[model samples]
Target: MLKIRNLSASIDGKMILKGINLDVNAGEVHAIMGPNGSGKSTLAAVLTGRNLYEITEGQVTYLGKDLLTMAPEDRARAGIFLGFQYPIEIPGVSMANFMRTAVNEIRKFKGQQPMNASDFMKLIREKIALVEIDTKLINRSVNEGFSGGEKKKNEIFQMAMLEPMLSILDETDSGLDIDALKIVANGVNMLKRPDNASIVITHYQRLLDYIVPDFVHILYDGRIVKSAGKELAVELEAKGYDWIKNHDGDE
Candidate 1:
């Protein structure tokens, strides 16, 4: 569903993501692992059209369309979702109101009419159950005063509502306790289907225990040096990233 070729991106004048080539077909989960500043987040930013990183080379094709040409909003409406590492707080805006506006706007993009309040509330209730979000949480301001786990769960709740075909979760496991981790992972797994794919960007191997990616990639310095099955995550957990750096070859 997504294909990238020799992708290179940079911010300001500094280069990051030297040359990344990856392909994700429908019904597959891909995990990207690397140390700090290895361009894991940068890849997500570039893919989502964050506007800071400029693509100097290569191209991305999403669902047979030129993904780089689409605006960020267009990408989202086109079934692209990026779950942020640090979910920002939107004070004074209740999640219900915020999501209602967002849902209507996306519907507008899709040439659909806005949903009535009755329908909107019913849909919200159903999605809230999908993520096991509390009634009080959705009525509060978006992520405002939420704990780390609450914020993360809210992100997945948004993902469930958006129903994106390609979900790029950048370090979704960060700061999550075991219970929160399981909840978020279960939400993600529930959203997975034969027609959708996910890119999980993470550091440690623990997250993989729940998500269980079909392919694991070692991204170093900017390029993906190796790609392997799920066992690669276990090996990395045992031997550390230095082992992959020393044996940088396709596995």
Candidate 2:
């Protein structure tokens, strides 16, 4: 559903992503593993058009559309969901209100009528259950005073509500306890469909245990240097990133 070729990006006049090439088809899960500063998150930011990173070269096509030309909100409406590595708190905005507005906006973009209050409430309740989020939290401000796990789960909850065609989950496993990790992974697994895909970016292999990937890609120095199966995650864990670093040679 998404194709990228020789994609490079930079921020503050300094280059980050040198050349990234990836193609994600429906019903597939791709895991990107790498050490710190390897541009995993940078790739996500570039795809989502975060406004800081400037695309210096290459192209990204999503569902046959020029994804780079669209605004970030338009991209979200086009079914691109980005689960942030560090979800920021938006105080004074109730989760219900925040999500209701977002959903309605997306609906408008699709030329559909806005969901009624009653229907939106029902939908939110059902989706919150899918992520095992507490209803009490919904009434509170978005990510306000929430723990790390709660923020990550909230991101998944938003993902469930939006039902994106391609989900970019960047370090969704970070700062999460085992229980929280399992809950997040289970939600992602349940949301998987034949017409959607996911790109999971993580440092540790533990997350892969719960959400098995069809392809495991080792992203180093802003480029995907190695691509393998799920077994690659296990090897990375046992051998560490240095093993790949020493052998692969720097760009």
Candidate 3:
């Protein structure tokens, strides 16, 4: 569904991603793991069309179109969803109002009529149950006064509702207890379909225990240094990132 070729990006004239290449197909879950400042989030930011980063060299093709040229809003409407690592608060905007607008906009992009109030509310209820979110939470302002776990669950809830083709979750497990983590991961698993895919970016192996990616990649020094099966994550957990650092120098 997505292909990246020699993707190089920079911020403020300093390079972050150098000669990075990746391919994500439908029905696949790929995990990106590395130490801090290894350019995991930078790659996500570049793919999402953040203006701060400049594409120094390379091309990104999504659904066989020039992905890098599309605007951020266009990207979202085109079935690309980025679950932010740090979900910001939007005061006074209730979740129902926020999502209703977003869902309708997506329909408009697909040349469909707006969803009626009755069907929209029914869809909302179904998604609320899918993410195991409290009914009252949807009435509250967007991420306003929400606890850390609540915020993360809310993001997953939004993802379930949007049903994107490519879901890029940047550190969705940053801060959460074991129970909350399972709930969040369960929602991701239940939402998985043959026509969809996910890019799971995380630092720890614990999250992998639940999501169980089809492939695990070790990114170091702004490039993917190693790629392997699920067993790679267990090895990384046992050996720590020092294993990668020591091996990276050898190559």
> lDDT (0-100) at residue 113 of candidate 2?
99
Assess every candidate by TM-score.
0.97, 0.97, 0.97
lDDT of 3 at 194: 92
| Each candidate structure's count of clashing pairs | 0, 0, 0
Instruction: Name the lDDT value of residue 124 in candidate 3.
Output: 95
Candidates' C-alpha lDDT: 0.92, 0.94, 0.93
lDDT of 2 by residue, 1-251 (tens): 99999999998988888888889999999999999999999999989989989899999999999999999999999999999999988999999999999999999999999999999989988999988878999999999999888999999999999999999999999999999999999999999999999999999999999999999999888888888899999999999999988866433
Question: lDDT tens digits, residues 43-140, model 1?
Answer: 99999999998899999999999999899988998989999999999899999999998888889988999999999988888888877778799889
Q: Which is superior by TM-score, 1 or 2?
A: 2
Q: Top model by lDDT, which number?
A: 2
lDDT of 3 at 228: 89
